[model samples]
Target: MTAALFLTSCSRKIIPGKPVLSSTRFTTDSLPLSEIDVPLRINLKPLYETANKNVQTIYGSPGWPNDFEVVNCDTRYMYRFKRGPLMITAHANTVNFNFTGSYIIAGAQRICTGTGSNRIPITPWTPTCTCGLNEGERRVNIGFKALLTLKDNYDVSAKLQRLEPRPLDKCTVCFWRQDITSTVMDQLKVQLDDTGNEISDSLNRLNLRSPFQQLWDMLNTSIPMFGMGYLQINPEKLRLSTLYAQNDTLNISVGISARPRISLTKTVGYRTVVPDISDFNQRKGFSIFVDAVMDYDSLSQLLTRELYHKRVDMDKTGKYIIIERCEIYGAGNEKLIIKIEFSGPDKGTMYLTGRPYFNRGKNQVEIKDIDYDIHTRDLLIKTAKWLFNRRIINTLNHYSTFNIAAYADTLLSKVNVQLNRQWQKSVSTAGAVNNLQVMAIYPLTENLVLRCNIRGELTVRIDAFDF
Candidate 1:
């Protein structure tokens, strides 16, 4: 795939080779809340399923026809998403003014004031929730990166070789010779079966074989041995969204809607991580659109302020969002669960890079208006964050690269690939072994090509190599 080459980058941060942002999101940094209330409930099951399945499909899966015959792909790969690469450093301080002694008494301060008195003093657990963070700063990079690689089964050459039929003890076609020559010569009769049915069976068998092979041949012949070229993967989209520029756009787009499939065990190199709230305190959304080189420190800075510096938006009250958990997948596959928190839902749509009139750059290509509720709007924002995550960061995971295959198979000439994803599984707090399937496909070309005749569901399950 095209991503095979030029794949030497890190797999951390929302979008590698991009900028970091800040926000004025209200959070208690100095004091870790005894009970940190995370209002967002993340359904990682779908995200995990989508990502894991994609990893299998990308490597050309094994054993199965979709899998490669030869072990050409690297199975020990994992798709990881990170928060930031830009570390913030800052110096802040606070001074305590004064303190007063306090005492606690129960039942109207009934004190015995005697040596044999069974009385105790108590005080309410009241402490001024205050902290003076002296002007201090350290490099707290909010970026995230992981080591991941995509793999599949065997090589195509091997699969074809294995599919070839070998000789059998009993030849199904031998009866044809007997039927054609039996009644003619004495020598031919010696080889014929005792029953005259061989003659009839031969005719019937021939007729059936003709249509079957003919159909097979027809389908195979229809399969363009050539036309399109090598395929490519956009790990950015998390789906294989193949590129085929046969028309005016002069660029390839997704070709199929079939969900990419993969096995669980084939996937290797997994490393899980939770967000660092302490570090996240720095990404204040949208302050002044600046570059990464400037103000790379200040872990206390909000992400909203950070984005403002990038010129993505200019908002007070730090109009921004924080995606608690999301699966990184392809462009078109929306089979992911996302959790997002925004100061105001209005700015939620802007978190993603699409048409301003409508969000998600996708349908906006046609529809002029987009609508959403507060919760749904936040969900969309979370999904956008996931789509933005890419595995183009880690170097070690960047093994042999691949390009989008030019040729596609099937009547619709559909193609499926794994573009971008971060997959993993876990027994949820509710004890559900959930699966996540995420991918993207470029479905339209000039004038909407091949809109009909396409449908299929991709299934994926993780397996342990040792098993």
Candidate 2:
């Protein structure tokens, strides 16, 4: 009876030794993958208007004066004239001036007195007389054109280069009352040139420190707050790429190079100079590899909830087995090792080993070719009738899949929603998930690391100036 029992337990006819697990493996890692590209568009009208307002505030007061003197001279006589109190009024498209002042004529005076000094009556003579004249208001309009350029410096500030003034119209009083409007106009031209120079100086000295500081604050404090689940962008640098003019708008392109990380704190600051990106080729899209780590504790909880203590019928003889505990570990070379302990009619432990790969079409991570470990298979073969259950192996194979693609899609949706909510008024972002695949799977100290390649396109629209 003992010999018969041994034969029955070791019989090949009773339990199959090798179970073929049909699955596919991808060997090519050089497949061309798409990338995520972010394009930003900015409008320049608001910046232009704001600059105009700033210029007006500095020079538009009524007390400021542009003083000039004109000499009315002829072969017979010469008279010195002075004009003062020139006020400036600035508009968006032009600057207007009003000069209304008392002009004093000096250098020649009449010496004839009213026939009373010392009873000596001098002949009443109309000598060359120096007189004070009140010149009425003179209005002049100076038109200008504004140009913008990206200045090369440590901070890379924006410069407004004001071109030469195109005088729209000018009117000046005739100081000599002898058709000398040309001479008076000449003096006014000199004064207008000085005023124009002042305007140019103000414009050239405009500092963009506040705007850039606000941008840094938004990027570091406001935008990253929506990275649900610790996802964030660690910006290493921001570089100016290109600046140009299109129609009435100024177009600027800035290149941002950053890394995506999982963080819980806000850490960033403003930098004047960024890394050299001159050789960084601008692409419409780019791809990134992200490591989504599942710690042992979380994996343990998930597996417990899904599979622990589950029972499976093993054979038709009313024998069944229950899983007492389950555990997962990373095997090198993109594989997972799952160890499961069984209870019920028999009590034993088994190990499952298989390679995990990304199913691009389904957007999920599936374990393929799962089978019993060598030691577990040997143990099962040794005690086939008492301890081995084929249903347990089938059950483990059926449930050994991770839905990574769905998780990625859900993550993308959450990020997009947050971006829209945060930047709806000033900026807009648009993108969608294109492809996701597993690149590698490795073991960390206490976690299973999964690296995946994600590809998509992101477009950013920035309203630089509000209407």
Candidate 3:
């Protein structure tokens, strides 16, 4: 009778119920709203050169306007002006121009004879006398200021702040012995107005939308992350900061709102068109809430590689179990269900459940309160009491953890590669991730999601300015 009891106990087969656990809604209120500052640096030297070229073209050939009539009729003055190279400078969206040139004046002077009461004019005017003609052209300087602003439609508007003409050399009429430099400068102011208008118009016609659209297109796509997954920027809204000019370079910060994520597979979605420029809000750096995913299949393989075919002693008795295979999946109720198939004195399947939590000190995600499922406990109590020992439970719990710090490092490296690379000709990005730390963990039916906060600085560089 004792031998019969022993045989029955050894041959008893354990089968636990595999009841599906109800899913729980995992909500995280701390998931941050992402903000990325994409600093747009444009080479303003090209723009300045282009503006100067346009101005030169508008001025036309040298010795331009061989003669400009300032005062005609009885006491007339005709002026001729020549301009040198155009110099353009920009500071804080204000553009200034300096044109150094020379000028000459020639005109007839009025002649009167005798006293005022009985005066009679010898001639309506004396022979045309010139000033600064043979004595070399008199020096003059023209300066202008343009206040530039970004319009809502992305057009650049330049308002003429002030345009002044200053004559540096004297231009005295030979007979009149009067300096006409100020008078000549007054006549030249009209031409300066036209030049100012030309500049303003040129700036107003500048098309900034095309370049911004190109940047928008570049950012809207998915970027591949080696050994991790794909990153979708998922940009929502955008705003532009005021223009900053330094060392002949213009920098504009483009702030973006995004919901970024990492997926095990590439995600394809409808591409969004770039919207109009929004209100200006100055901000720096980036704060992103990124969902980093780990597929259950990958997690299972990682755990199985460490625990596969491992032998564990049940007790002092000769009885032992070898883990033939293991599978991990979400069992709902914020718990992870691990299924282990083993070969031992009793060959059967057992299930364990645990709540996963992040251990900040270890930088790991460890399973806590790990033990056999309720059904597994019931079956083990009846058939195989040896398998329900704490030693076995401890072994499973110890091996169920994953090092999140290492994963975060790998993820950052992969993401940085995509962030800091040349996107196309004359367009590139320079980015640095300050920190990417896991904030929360959620085990869903499909995969494990690690909600992370990524702080970084990103800048978009344009080597050439086409617009």
Give the best candidate by lDDT: 3
Write the residue-wise lDDT of candidate 3 on 1-467 in tens digits: 01111233545445576635666776544446699887888877767776676664333123334642423233556666667777777788887878887776677666556664555556666677876678887888888887778876788877885467777888888657677677767767766777777767777778677778777776677778886788887777788998776656778989988888888887785566788877677888999998877888888887888889889897777788888888888855688888888877777778888887888889898889988887788777776788888877888887989997887888888888877898888888888897987888888777888888899899898877576
Best by TM-score: 3
Could you give the candidate ranking by TM-score, starting with the highest? 3, 2, 1
- Clashing residue pairs in candidate 3 are none
lDDT of each: 0.19, 0.48, 0.76
Error of 1 at 328 (Å): 10
| Candidate 2 to truth, TM | 0.61
In order of lDDT, best first, we have 3, 2, 1
- Cα lDDT for residue 54, candidate 3: 68
Regions more than 4 Å wrong, model 3: 1-19, 27-30, 56-85, 101-139, 167-180, 344-348, 374-389, 413-420
Q: Candidate 2 on 1-467: residue-level lDDT in tens?
A: 01111232422222222222333352324323223345555544455554444443222112222322212222122323233333433332233333333222222212333443333323432343333334433333343443433344312232223223232223222323353344434544554455445545644565433343434444444234344354434444554545444543333444545554433334453444333333323456547565555665666566656787798886776876677777776533345667776666555556777766666666666667777766556656666554456576678667766676556676677655654543546655666556656766654444665666666666555555322
Instruction: Find the 10 residues in a row with the least total lDDT in model 3.
Output: 1-10
In angstroms, the error of model 3 at 226 is: 4.1
Q: Model 1: runs farther than 4 Å from truth?
A: 1-216, 220-311, 314-368, 377-467
The Cα RMSD in angstroms, rounded to one decimal, for candidate 2 relative to the true structure is 10.3
